[model samples]
Target: MSGMDPSAVPGPTVVDRRRLVFGVLPAAALLAAGCGRSNDDRSDGGRSARPPLALVYNGPQGCPACPETVAALLRGAPRPYRVEYVGGETPLTAAALADARLYVQPGGGADLKGTWRHLEGSAGAIRNWVREGGGFLGLCFGAYLAGRNPGFDLLPGDTNGYIDSPGATVTDGRDTVVPVNWQGRPRHMYFQDGPAFFLDPGADATVLATYPNKTAAVVVAPYGKGRVGVSGPHPEADASWYADKDLSNPDGVHFDLAYELIEATAGRR
Candidate 1:
């Protein structure tokens, strides 16, 4: 948790339908069926008339960046990676999360709430998703979920509410700025503060990035043929998202890292 930037950062809030723009990567085209299933679900690269990927976001409704990101993945993925936003209705069945070859969780605090966390589903399914050749990624709160038992059990971190973090964002007032650590000073950071989650040593998580306070910024864990990755930061958000929330971040706001990671994940299948 050392060598992180010394400020706090945040995640995206709400996303309207119109804000999303869908486009296909013509070179790697496939049918909608394969676009939503993981590789394991398909017999022939998901081109054999089956789904390619199934995403279990299982969180509260009306997430702004959620739909847009899912739309982009379904439309832009080079390997027919179908993306679906599971409305947080019922808890995740052990079979549901296990059926896929890969799973992605964006950085919403509530995304890790309720039956989703503490692994309401079967612990075996959670372990199988990563231990038995399934792939997974967690962002912010999603990363927090990886640490808890019954959850994916990737990074052993704790989630905390905001206190003394330095970052900027708009809440109620125009031009209003909240504090959270971002890329760095004078670099501008946007944030929607969430709970503070720190990594636990026994978890054996492989971290990628973080706040200046040595927190679990980005972490990865390798289990069996399955893999677990997390971003204490939201590297997939855009500028409009931060402006709408009145926040500034320094890690280069426009990010394709999430997609790159997914690309590697999709390759496994």
Candidate 2:
């Protein structure tokens, strides 16, 4: 990873959590009505009281599989949790995040700048929310958005395409599985135009996984009192996403990696 000059990037805007609470309550209420049904919906014979929510961005900026795949992964978490869709018609407002334990920004198409355009409105809200102890998980394109340039500036460093990194194995944007060392365990995970994180000097970010090139592929860091986790691969991807690609994970479909990320970002691990 390369060192970045922290001064070159704007830092997070400080906001009083108390003021944010009172300001967005009404908007959050209206936004919640349009969110997706919880995994614990009573109509599905699940518990009447919904568990804590994980709000996922399902807007046009994200790929078709991004939102649903992530929601499926969240449903398999160790603890009880609910899934809610945000973005597009349902904007991600401060109120919408009030009750959410986590906010996920999934992989999108290759256009990072375009994705930021759609998400710029919620940038301040997300930054402030995470600072107040809410968790954030970014996957693939989402990880790119966690950087300083064309992103939310959540990380002290910057992000670049993994395909262009030194010693990178997968050199294209095709759908395929690539080699990764996840916490010292060898594994193959779905990859596309993922990102390689470059932390600034002395930044206290934890590297959870690495590309074959040994660049940071997955990392977790502190944002005020909250936590931020970003992955360069698609751990939330399901079998359906691999169809016709002739690709497969020897370990089969699993949510372990995704769950690990959730747990870490939510401060449960």
**What TM-score does each of the candidates earn?**
0.59, 0.80
**lDDT of model 1 at residue 259?**
62
Point out the worst 10-residue segment of candidate 2 by lDDT: 28-37
Q: Candidate 1 — what's its lDDT?
A: 0.45
Displacement of the residue 97 alpha carbon in candidate 1, Å:
4.0
Say which candidate scores most in lDDT.
2
Question: What would the per-residue lDDT of candidate 2 be over residues 1-269, giving only the tens digit for each residue?
Answer: 11113322111111111222234322211110001112333222367776678898987652454566677678766764678889877899999988888999876444455566788899999999999898989887678778765678898687887877888897654556788899989988877657888899899899999998899999999998899999888787666555434568877867788788888888321
Reference-based TM-score, model 2:
0.80
* Pairs of colliding residues, candidate 2: none
